[model samples]
Target: MCVNAGKDKESAQPPGCPVSRPVPAKPAQRPERVSLLSYLLRFRRDILSAQPARLYRAWMAEFRTPFFTSFLCNDPDLVNLVLTERPGDFPKSGRLFEALQPLLGHSIFITNGKEWERQRRIIDPAFESGRIREVFPAMWDAAVAAVGRLEPLADGRPIDIEPQTSHVALDVIFRALFSIPVEDRTASAVFDAFRAHQASRPMINTGSLLPLPRWVPRWRARKTKATARIIRGLIRQLVDERQADLDAGRAPDDLATRIMTTADPQDGSTFSPEEMADQVGIFLLAGHETSAAALAWALYLMALFPDWQARVAQEAEAVIDPGRIYFSTASKLKLARAVFRETMRLYPPVPMYLREAARAERFRARDVPRGAQIIVSPWHLHRHERIWRDPDGFDPTRWDTPEGRESSRRAYIPFSAGARVCPGSAFAMTEGQLILAMILRHYRVALAPGHTPVPVAQLTVRGRDGIRLTLTPRKTETP
Candidate 1:
């Protein structure tokens, strides 16, 4: 029987299944305003708080500045047009590159036109569906290791799960890419430096928003630059070592090896050592940080809804053998997968994606000038009042319903969509589901007393103070 099985249906909807769901901490209500200064100030605190509640219903909204015009698109059709149909006309904003250049340096995340195309061509094969299956064992090993680490920490004390998830995600990336665990000193150093770098940089810096002169110098704090240098140096070391291993014919067959050797089909060009470092930096940052944010929020949601957690645990026991998780068995974790998907809809990791118009375009009957900033916000679209029914509620079972299926097909884009969609989407989903199942199989998660997480957008959407939860060992009966 499920955790809510014994009570009347009305009373037993689910634990924490009030008429309303528990939303992460939101900013206090403020009077509406359109001033750029106000937006900048509010954005520094929380990106969600920076926008007006009206965006939840507006199909499209525009903001004009002395430097550039910006548009926020909420309509699904416009979103599809920008992301899928006419993506070529909307290149990644130069302002985004300016802000991230110190750390990312021409990475695929911030490139445009032919440069972006060439990089994707070389990188895409490493993330193909078949390649993901080849890499699943590494992910599984990391998930098992994470469960082992958590076992001793399941002592019913309030624990900040964000860092824990980050650790596990980094471990997974390292193992998948280099055939090494994060415990390796160079890997550990890069991980530590990344955390420091993220602390020093906001997701949307002023340079990306404000119109500043080209020579104004986008100021980066010394600490941020130092950390970026340290991170890049560590990655370069790994790349050099991998190159030496390849030359000697002893290289491990992993992501790094595959990427370094794959040449552009059109030109037979390969990534240079410096270029390889940039790509690795992005893979580590994007792959781990986003996955970490998703996992932490998912665990928090499981804690908030114990009945759902119980169902996930039961499913895990039925499908996953004790002390063993296999790539072949991942498809059996249906309930866990639904829970993970719902968590993403509520707390998308990369909350907003920014692009700039490459040429004049018309969207929703409005004239958009070339160089205008285009914002496609997954955060708003996921909870759009006009799109989602019970938009703020936590109901994983909705996956089984017609409305839920329709909404997912249309509005759900935790990984964004179209040509530039995240290549590792499949890998991320498999990893998240595996970790959720492994954790739930051995533990019951609950929120700490009086604890609430405030959602903030740094490089990824994360709890401002951190997500605190209590874990207790679960006693499972043999099937």
Candidate 2:
């Protein structure tokens, strides 16, 4: 049975297509009228579903609050204006900062103003061009390890792939950052704690919508704090150990060493141990979780669209050398890169970026007030009805065309845009494309019969019930 059979049949392909393209999880239709309380309750389940259908076409939508107003912006120009042109006027929202404080503290992911700039100044060089290539081997090893882990799961039984991808992604971050695989006790503990923390918190900061004093004493659940502490403690241990290594002039030239030793040019200061822990927390959370989600969705999409999968596998066979996956060879996986890009478009890892107006400002002829929430929803813009042709459909080949390129320039922002854009965007693309190529080259993935991936935003976009698929070993000569 088609997973999206309930959707309009006209949008679906004619009969006898090799495989049915997977449609993203859509929100349940909203009642003609509903109270804000009811909507908020539903929103806790899935943000995408909580939205009204008209939002898919609307340029901007407003939600009123006793304390503050929030706007979801879908206009391409407006989005660019907020994210790129006037980012200083729209800082990261306080509600988001308060909600994430238990986990991220003052990590770069949440900070704004001069502090954000300082963190970025110190952290950016760690991911500079040369460093990405240096890290390629670690990413390659993790991809290969992931393939080995999945080999035993190719017996046709259903497999929940989210955990598997999470494991591999965690392994990648561990090895790349500290030169230690996730098998280490402390690393494993951090990974487990992170999972617990994510389970205990809402992916979206709905609390931001509530009008409460910034000092109202935000209440974090006990489990959330406990888990965050465990994760931070473990990260601190790693950072301290790396510090010792650096002091002894024995530190390996990995991401951790580089980040720790690279002082801020202006202040000539490094991340103190606690600060380092905070940065690592964001790195592990953002780096691994987002990539894991994207990879799982990419594989599921491949399973749903075998023709594209076959093309990817063929490209991998022709381009990727099994003996060694190098940085130079990564760009050769063009089809695989396209698949990753499209997957992000359909299910952006960080679905919506939340910011607040720093001062009263008018936008799109609407009155704005200080403290108003400004939501730039990549999820909505990527699939905006007025933007891309066949917005919801998966077409990897479209990326090569002029229209697709133009739309991407205007509307696509999976990693976001402007100066505050994710610094690790290039690293992530390499990791994602390489992993996808490696997996498709070795295994033929198919959606488990009677299973459909229900997308939900956890720390990042994930399958609510977990993505279930079957892996079959591919019998092909490695390039």
Q: Name the best candidate (by lDDT).
A: 1
Per-residue lDDT of candidate 1, residues 1-479 (tens digit): 33434222546565565433455444443457757777777777677777888887889999886867999998989899999988898888888888788788889998988999999999999999999888888988888788878888999999999988998999999999999998899999888998898888778677556677767777777888898899889999999999999999999999999999999999999999999998998899888999999999999999877778999999997888765646777899999999999999989999988989989888888999988999999998998889998887787888899998988888899988999999999999999998899889988899998788888889999888899999888886421
All candidates' lDDT scores? 0.87, 0.86
Residue pairs that clash (backbone atoms under 3 angstroms), model 1: none
lDDT of 1: 0.87
- The Cα RMSD in angstroms, rounded to one decimal, for candidate 2 relative to the true structure is 3.2
Q: Count the backbone clashes (under 3 Å) in each candidate.
A: 0, 1
lDDT, candidate 2, 60-102, per-residue tens = 9888856568999999988998999999999998878877887
- Residue 311, candidate 2: C-alpha displacement in angstroms: 1.0
